[model samples]
Target chain A: MTAVRPFRPRSGFHADQRAGRLFAAYLVSLLLHGLLLFALAGGWPGHAARSDKPPVYYVDLVHKPVLDPQAGRPEPRTPDTPVPAPPEKAPVRAAVPAGPAAAGSTDRRVAAALEKLRDERALQEKFAAMRQAQAVPKETPVGLSDARGTEAGVGTLAYVQAAIQQNWALSPYLLADPRKAAGVEAWVRVTYSRNGRLERFSFEMESKDAQFNESIKRALVKSQQLPQPLPERLEEVRVVFNLKAMKDLAGLR
Target chain B: MELITNAGLVVKLVLLILAYFSVTSWAIIIYKTLVIQRATRDSARFLDFFWARRRFDVIAQGLDDFRHSPLAVLFRDVHQELLQNRRAADGGGEGLDADLGEQDRVARVLRRATTSETHRLEKYLAFLATTGSAAPFIGLFGTVWGIMDAFHGIGKSGSASLAVVAPGISEALVATAIGLVAAIPAVIAYNHFVNKVNVLIGEMDNFCQEMLNVVQRLPRSRQER
Candidate 1:
């Protein structure tokens, strides 16, 4: 039988043949890409971003926000004073109508309000007494303890300001083509844990735009925990997010 | 526009690669289209000429004309195998036995030749495949990087307005657009060329079968070394 060797085909010369053309294609590719980039960049030249009336006061700060909770009111506002409660065992209590007076609706309403005021006063006094009882015996006076923890720690004021300023981002909502509110204000009470992380913070601040308020809140959250360790026995802390500081940083004079 | 121009270095480099791929893919498209068209036509004409002849010797004289054709290469390989075996056996009783057994061995040689031709037809097709599959993800990575930079810019500027955000995002999108542009044609061309190559290879396989039949029909007395 004939010994048939396996047929082996020679390699095609086309790839080698097209070497110059392929290189040329590469050049053309680069040129085309450059043109695309140029077109994307230069297309619609003079495309101006029309802006709206600038915001009024860039930002405002209500040191405590009376509701946001208000501006540095050292004393909590008191409701109108309630009439003094009658003695607990006084015989006069039996003579008084229970609430629904048989004579008139106005009389009944007044009696009911007076009774309610008495109950609230007694409750407040009981709470005060309970608080006094719970207080540990210490060298510092009770009145001075609350007054001692100021709204902000004197030592960390600059550090806190810098950290908040660095973390806070101004969104388009605050600075858009046509701006919305002239300015926004917020009050934040940040209480820190021993580990320097936020323990609890009262952050619900009111603004014309909810989104604007949220952005500021987010900035506070994004601080990755504050830079300094909290002072032992210090708790009360408050910060005012004023747009004025941010605008200054942005050089928007 | 400024966003893209001022995009991070990595982003710019990604865009550059996408551009290169786009250019090379299109180049391949143009080149392959012309080459395949010529190859198909040559194959058809060569097939006609091959079948027109009754004798193998007469068919070989015109091989140069179809040298570029894949089918022509197949024929040359089988022909060479035939010549080798024929020369190995001198004209005697051994030549007779060799001729009887030659056809089957010749068929095997034809199969191998056809495979080689198919390999030639499919050259450079893998590049098209890789570009088609990977470019979109590459562009996506670039876009993701760009968005990260945009957010970083926002953090730096302390402005979250779209006025500040729009440019960076738009610049990032350019990468994705270019990547798609580069990949689309490559995918299409790859599918088309693969189909065409398959068709051409099928024709070669059929030609092998037909050649075997033709050789089988020829008289053993005429099968000389």
Candidate 2:
């Protein structure tokens, strides 16, 4: 090989610069990695995308429509023919004394007008009774706990009823009480926490029979913890317990 | 932090491995960036110096400043080969035949130098490729192990509620996120550096051919003459 010639001292300088740069870059990279780990360890509060709100559950308490479809249907109109004068016309006659032919005709017209007004009032009363019949059935004595919260559905209400009924102890002797059996009904209001703990309770409407009311109180006490936790929004329920209705619900004679 | 701190031991191990991969690969990316950029800049400037100066001795003396340039290395190697051939021809009193042989020897030297320069440019790039390909799977391994632990927890607790399972799953998923974090930059840097190296290789090859032509025309080394 030809003798190697020594060049100016630029190579060492270049190599030294490169080494310095590489070292600096390594340090920067280490600092960046440290920052990343620090940020991760800090948890970056509120940056999490997950929602914290509890899922809301909706329950349909009343499966059937509250208003009857037939109640809203227009009533059939009666023909406008003049109504015949019946014994009820005595009041109209008493108002009109003996008069000339023209005066008598006007009095007859007045009596007819009064008769039409009475018929219209009777029709309105009949419609009112029909509407009332179509309204929601009143509290059943079988203790279908009324869940007033919007979130409580038919299933939840049924669950509450079943849980309470499972712990209820209705004595056969109380049902056999001849004088008070039919009249033994009590309304109890119960409130619960999210964890199924019974928070508070009171007798909203108590029965006159002390024994029957005591039995209702005992059932509530026994069912202190519901089988399932109450829905978040459902906290209070009003339960009506009637001895006769309970007997009927249980298929007991 | 709780997500990582509360993670299972296996997942934490995986995260640690990924962190290693990420930090090292980033360092490699930085070092390579500086190296490739210097090589490219110096190579272009060396080409300018080579064309401007006609004397081989001047070019050889200037090679030190362009030491990072692959073209400069190729020129230096071929120039040394030409010098050796010139000495052999002058000492042996063989001119015509030795000149032809000298061209062949110089060509061989050019090829070897091109190969060496390419190797230098491509150094340290394999680690980036390895990090890109392996990190994600390693992270996935951690995630699978975490989920297994979570299910095991459920079996022991006898509870399958979201509250019981969610925290475990969240912690497990963190491994996957970290794996992706480690892999993405490595993959990007690997691709970028590969392209840069390829461009340098092409320049070196072209310079090798150009240097061979110049050596052929010289017929003999100027220093020997």
Candidate 3:
């Protein structure tokens, strides 16, 4: 009788041989697929290379303002007046005078001499009154309180006063009613660049009309420099344009 | 005619194609991730139920319930072979003493079953690997085509300014981005599924050997009865 052999399970079959084959197949397929993808997409490296360069951009320059070195001093001509050219032949015209013109001119000269004497008297009286006022020391006037000994402070104050006087003055031709503009008061805020060019201009308060705003904008644009060079640390120029004082002077209702 | 006849059109078409691939790849990635997750959970639950019963007859009877499971399919094949061998021995008047022949038959059945299940688990996984490995290259092709067209357009348009070059290049680049979107998830899923299937196959192989050991140890009366 043959003895039954003890059941010996083969470990070879138990080993993951199939798994290895599957893994190998998987890897091979992965490689082939990778190759196919590369062929289709042009590969990862090429895509990365393209991403490295950024697109270029172009922009246009606009709104540049020219600056003149000297500006902001009082202009000689008022809006109401026109500048007259010098007479080319004054001497010849003066010598050839008509008989009625000569007689009238003599009479006008006599009257002008009398008027000049009266003006001198009035000027003498005004000088005397100023001396008396100086002799009696009193409280400093409110208007003079802001007066500064520094050259820059004085210059800036003078510029502000002059600008206010020139633009805010009442004339029948300047406004619908000369008295109406007197009530308009505004603060001008000015910004300048390092090279003394006006960079920005604005009003702290609204102007009486769009025309006033436009005029201020034009004034700053036209003035290449402030009335005086700003102090080294200060680049912004600010001043109040007071129309209320003009209204008072004109006696507006 | 010159305005319309530029490389820009080609670049746009390539970009559109890449965009389609990229959007689809991302969708596949999300879908496959969910599928693999659910498969893993189901497989684990089935394995737990199979082992907890501790009786081969109960597991064999219930295998049909687990027919959708890859592991269950492997087990069913082995069980069928055991039943067939038992029936054959009964016909031969061996009275169930044909233990050696039965063992041989069972091993053969298991080996064949293992191969089939492995094949089933690995199905569709190849597509993932292909996408992962190839998507970037596909995108690059589109970009290259676009760049070539851009140069051609430049040759005809007589200008190399930014306006002429940027739009074309931008459109071309969309393809490469799409390729990457498709490839990354596929590569990840391929790796993940491979690992999971390998582990299940190992478990199945181990279980087959255990069943063989149990069958070999049965008493003669029990085997015949």
What are the RMSDs of all candidates, in order?
19.4, 19.0, 18.7
User: Candidate 3 chain A, which ten residues in sequence have the lowest lDDT sum?
Assistant: A60-69
- Alpha-carbon DockQ of candidate 1: 0.15
TM-score of each: 0.50, 0.53, 0.45
Q: Estimate the lDDT of model 2.
A: 0.72
Model 3 has a clash total of 16
Candidate 2 TM-score restricted to chain A: 0.38
lDDT of 1 by residue, A182-219 (tens): 46677777765644576666764665667767777787
User: Among these predicted structures, which one has the highest lDDT?
Assistant: 2
- Candidate 3, residues A43-157, lDDT tens digits: the string is 6677768867999974311111222112211123334333333223322124344598597887677677668767766776676555544443353211223332322123333
The number of the candidate with the highest TM-score is 2
Give the Cα-based TM-score of candidate 2 against the true structure.
0.53
Docking class of 3: incorrect
Give the poorly placed runs of model 1, Cα more than 4 Å off.
A1-253, B1-3, B91-100, B220-225
Note the residue pairs that clash in candidate 2. Answer: A59-A153, A60-A154, A61-A154
Q: Sort the predicted structures by TM-score, highest score first.
A: 2, 1, 3
lDDT of 2 by residue, A1-253 (tens): 4333333211222342456766787788889998876666654555444445568996534332221122222223334422333333334444545567678788778878888878876776676555543443443222223333323134444556666776777777666556655757788888866666778888899889887787877877888886556554235678888788777766665
Q: How displaced is residue A33 in candidate 3, in Å?
A: 22
Ordering by lDDT = 2, 1, 3
